[model samples]
Target: MLALPAESVSEADVIAGILALMRERTGYDFSSYRAQTIRRRIRNRMISVGIHTLTDYLVHLKSVETEALELLDRLTVKVSHFYRNAHTFDMLREEVLPGLYRRFGGPLRIWSVGCARGEEPYTLALLLEAAGIPGTVLATDIDEAALRAARRGIYLRDALRELPESLIGTGLEPVPGDERHVRVRPALRRRVHFQVHDVTGTALPLGTTDFHMISYRNVLIYLQREVQERTLLQMRAVLRDGGCLCLGEAEWPPPSVACSLSPLPQRSRLFEAIAAEPIA
Candidate 1:
């Protein structure tokens, strides 16, 4: 019988080791993430540290506290902005929200999973307020630092520069005395609640809400197929019948599951839940 070649560890192993440390220390798991992208990020960290061997790098990570956290931040990929996709916002404003309003008259509930830095949930609050819809938003993320930043509800001026002039005019008011930070209006801010939550773990802190909409965009791409399926199932359980689930333009549900697809204008990926049949 031929003996198997010794398993050669590379930069990827170093990357995985660091991520595993984060999971153990912080309880935020990225173990199920796509390997290639994780490898690339780890390689970048290796170059930054000037370490060649995975074994050496693991030892280095154990010694350095701040550097390890910085690496984890880099790997988590928390890039987000207010109304990041204009077309999707437009669809929500014009089509989906109106339908939801007609169906569920007042006090609507929305969830923004993986809500990095609160932009998306705050944007939803602004939109709902502008449209004269009474709603509360539950915004959750795995990163505590990100959640804290979001809870502050302050953003740099440049972050809002690209916001639609109409939305800026109606929804947001500039922060007095601080040119750099913009505060979400009192009413809109009151409607949004931010919490730190691990998506791969148990359900969020809130109770079972009558969720008419969920914005879970750009999050599923990082998760493995099994995690994605479980997350989607949990999302479906929370969502009301005929409610909508919005994904980032680049993201899509796995082909195996069945859900109603309602393509919004300008290529917005607004999907409505298919109503279940009543028991006889």
Candidate 2:
């Protein structure tokens, strides 16, 4: 990949070439991402890899599987923290959990789709535990590096900045010798599972409408609108009727998705699945 005259290629041609190489060699597709973001990321990756053009980067990907995976990881990295949206988690803790507990009983199952670094799922587990509701969380992400970090179940002290002091030690315990880090309690870890999965891929991790809630915050905004619609439909199919779907604060479902879901009275980002399509 180094020998080719990468400097002469147009930026458009370079991004196209990179996209093509990803599709052909790895079967990973970035086509649904916003074009501007794609271009910026390609350029950034080029700089990181010491390459001046996407064409040379394509050649580099072909030669190094590890580097290819690293690029994929970089493109998908998410900087999420425990209880990202305080108000949303507060609502879940006070109103949503109690209602769901009355409706479905304890030991409910949750799926945190597009989970990056495990904060969302861990927060759910912590919330449920604090609320005296027993639930299991299944967190999935497309980035392997993110999943690996989630599996470690450890986080820096500042990750607690958003937390209220009263809730401390309920879900997190300080590591034996480290003052600057805390580990999600081993018991909570048992309740939250992490796996690597691409939501847009051919297969879904969930085979039925079994989940009670799917906390897929902040991820849909990265995908194109049509992809967001299709992903919502897929989510509807797998989410049990009456289940809750949590999204990032700035995101809203298209009307097509809103048709099958009802927004909670107070929360804009939280929706209840209604009259979902029956699963096969």
Candidate 3:
């Protein structure tokens, strides 16, 4: 029997070592993530890949680049749906987009940070179509695999479960001879671009373009608090004055960032960016 070191025997110690390895190899910090969540996810990944020990897994990460990518993908959560949180989409359609449409004088540039499999951006394309507005959506995610799938623009039949029926075929095409697959239409795909990015990194590409609205919904909750704050500042930099920034309903910005934003009257999760002394 191989004897592991007494110092590395405890589960806590093992998890810490694994985390350090992850940060070192990826350069994306996750030290502030919820410990229980990361622990559970990595443990699950280990078991699935037949990695019996955390120490062994650390060794595996160094040798296998694909495993590292898979580990990163597993660590991040990517739950999204078209017209997700329908009330929120309803708010965007009824109130938010029109407000931006007037301010930007027609074509609106929107950002969907941490966009997984391109649901939100494609949804935005459909919404803009319905509203009779020209718009472009830049969708980004940290997972390269997810971004590849997003670019492919095909989804399972069940993926449209929450989307309204009338809005379905307008921006998406069902795969021929296959009932289970749907592809985002060529015209709609043209309006959205997908990119790979790690939001925790210092060099996130928000482009030089000023965005009228950003849909960063649900992604920040998984990050460490400091990361969440840094992400807010990054988004603040590219957001045009008076642009909209929508976060998950359960989320809150760091106190310093909160001062620079004003909440929408009907929705507290949504904020309108306003000028404040920039944080360095």
Best-matching candidate per TM-score = 2
Query: What digit string (tens of lDDT, one per residue) describes model 2 on residues 1-280?
Result: 2234635777667677777777776567888877777766666787787887566687888788777677776667587888887999889988887888889997788999888988889889988888889889999988877889899989998887887777768989989999899999987898988877887775787533488888878888778888888888888778888889899999998887888788998855999989844333
* lDDT score for candidate 2 against the true structure: 0.81
Worst lDDT window (10 residues) for model 2? Answer: 1-10
Candidate 1 global lDDT = 0.77
Give TM per candidate.
Answer: 0.87, 0.89, 0.88
For model 3, residues 151-230, the per-residue Cα lDDT tens digits are 99898878888888988978888799998899999889888988877777778674636889888888887877788898
C-alpha RMSD for every candidate = 4.5, 3.9, 3.4
In each prediction, how many residue pairs overlap at the backbone (N, C-alpha, C within less than 3 A)? 0, 0, 0
Give candidate 1 misplaced runs (Cα > 4 Å).
1-15, 50-53, 260-266, 276-280
lDDT per model, in order? 0.77, 0.81, 0.82
Best by lDDT: 3
lDDT of 1 by residue, 70-136 (tens): 6677677788888888878877887788789899887889999989988899889888988988888
How well does candidate 1 score on lDDT at residue 246? 88
